[model samples]
Target: MKVKPWLSHLKPYPPGKTLEEILKESGSLTTIYKLNSNENPLGPSPKVIEALRKSLSEIHLYPEASYLTLRKALSEKWEVFPEEVILGNGSNEVIEFLFKAYLFEGDEIIVSEPSFLMYTKFAEIYGVNIKRVSLTGELCHDLEGILKALSPKTKMIFLDHPHNPTGQCLKRKDWEAFFQRLPKEVLVVMDEAYGEFIEDEEVPLGIEFIKKGYPVMVVRTFSKFYGLAGLRLGYGLGRKEIIQELEKVRQPFNVNLLAVKAGLSVLSDLEYQKKTRELVLTGRKFLTKALSELGFKVYPSEANFIMGDFGKRVDQIYEALLSAGIFVRPLKAYGFPTSLRITIGIEEANAKLIEVIKRTISG
Candidate 1:
């Protein structure tokens, strides 16, 4: 059997190495620290853990196909109707659904170059042409460039808010301007995976645009601040019609029962969410300050991670950190060879990282 032509040239997506794999690869488990993936250093919430334990015995059963309970809980939290919500194995699935439901062969999707790799990956997988617009000098979405690139064949515009690796955002006014010039049939997806960490009021939430009758979807994940990446639960909010369209592509029982129950528990755990937010904010400040003082170009961030350009010494620093069992992400895959994206860890992990970098640079 012959595979699709598009599948031949496409490279597989790279996942961050797991702790176990890191230990095996490095030959040492003792001193290892993982800041590579932007996962919560604090781990999952206690309430979620309790909920998961309660759900353990029910693993034999398939989850409710509609995931109604989780949707209802999210609806109450976001003040939207349950019909407007769609659950996914992760927000990534929701993204895939958009393409599956709306895109025909030869259709195009516009996305910021080096924003989220998955948009490009998904486009490639689904045999859609991707019109890549470069990020502005500030590393945020170039709304004007994207708007200019839109065509009748464009099905969607994928934007990652508080954008990945760069930690920059598109302001509300910029979006308003872009939307005014956008084609009415084109869908805009705001991937707000990092929304909980945003400190800027000027950046528009995707939900706000959707409520105002814009053809948009706000894709959110419990992975970041809710600390549930392992459970792989995420969702989208949009017009009820848009959600219904996605539902047609969704697999029955896509979201497992444990994740649904855990998500429900964590959605109401405001105190836990607050703690995770505050921790990331504080750690971001400390690390940004330290890195800037050391003369690295630390970009202004409103997320749980910081991106810094270390000039040509980035490779040396990265290797040194690896030797010391500290794993942070290098942005070579994102076409940023001299830059690093580091997840904000606990206070001790943050301090240890600073110490390691200091020694690496000085030595």
Candidate 2:
């Protein structure tokens, strides 16, 4: 009886500190900003609340095996055929579906260094090879480098647009250039978890590539904009053939009942979607300006969070923010020890974070 020999030293995914854990260390702060995880500061849409309540009676029954309704809803939203959509428990499950559907024991996947931890984590889990390329000095994906890194054994590449930790997105020209050189044999999976928050018109969505007949899969979630992170609702869009292959390995009822209800309800709640976009955009502008004025090098972000570089004072500033009932994400685990990832929280949270940072540095 033995585990895979490769798994002996594989590290487990590190989740952020929980509220209870934060409170214990901070000695009972009365109000916590809790911006670490990039969750929508707005709670679930009102429509989702009602739908979840209505779905309570169905808890005893199994969810629809094929989850056709939710799948159909997503397909219509993206203008893809029903068979081209795959409903996943979260976008993570769909990502794993790619691994399950395609890769062999020694196959490889190319990833940006420190982009998304799960990409490398899954590759390790399946004993797939990982080829990591560092992001450009400007902190955006090095698309050219990735094309050069591919091999006959390369099965996929994962790109997280409005990329993690730093929140830098590639321009349209760069994306097109990359795709032009990419070989059709390797699939490119765009992890657009933060896609909704994009404000720049020049930043293109992965669906644009899919429509052009590229071997691309676009993974998205209802978590951020719709405030359904707790529900674990997500989906993937690709050509029907790829979607069909992935579906074969996807477990029936993978998406829970309430999540389906919440997803459909949220998609219809245009007012809620409007409010969230305004909140993120307005807060993003406010934080970027404020953080920059305070001498932090705030990068351009199309996501709901911005990355700020604090130089040698990172730990001092992080602990100070924690004491003041604010919790921003530290990027040491993402390999940027001197930077912090601050979510574009509600107006009050955004303002309070600024006030605390000002006080911390001035003192």
Task: Give one digit per residue, the lDDT tens place, for model 2 in 1-363.
Answer: 899998999998887777788788777678878798888998889889999898998899998898898889888888888898999988889899998989888999999998979898889989999999999898988988898898888989999998998888988898888888888898899999999999899999999999999889999998788899888988999999999999899998899999999999999999999999999999999999999999889999999899999999899999888889888899998999999999889999999989988988999
Looking at model 1, residue 165 earns an lDDT score of: 86
lDDT of 2: 0.90
lDDT of 1 by residue, 143-246 (tens): 98998898889989999998998887778888998888888899999999999999889977888899888888999998888888988999999999989999
Residue 168 error for model 1, in Å? 0.9
In candidate 1, the residue pairs with backbone N, CA or C atoms under 3 Å apart (3 or more residues apart, or in different chains) clash, namely none
When superposed on Cα atoms, how far off is each prediction in RMSD?
1.2, 1.0
What TM-score does candidate 1 reach?
0.97
Report how far off residue 37 is in candidate 2 (Å): 0.6
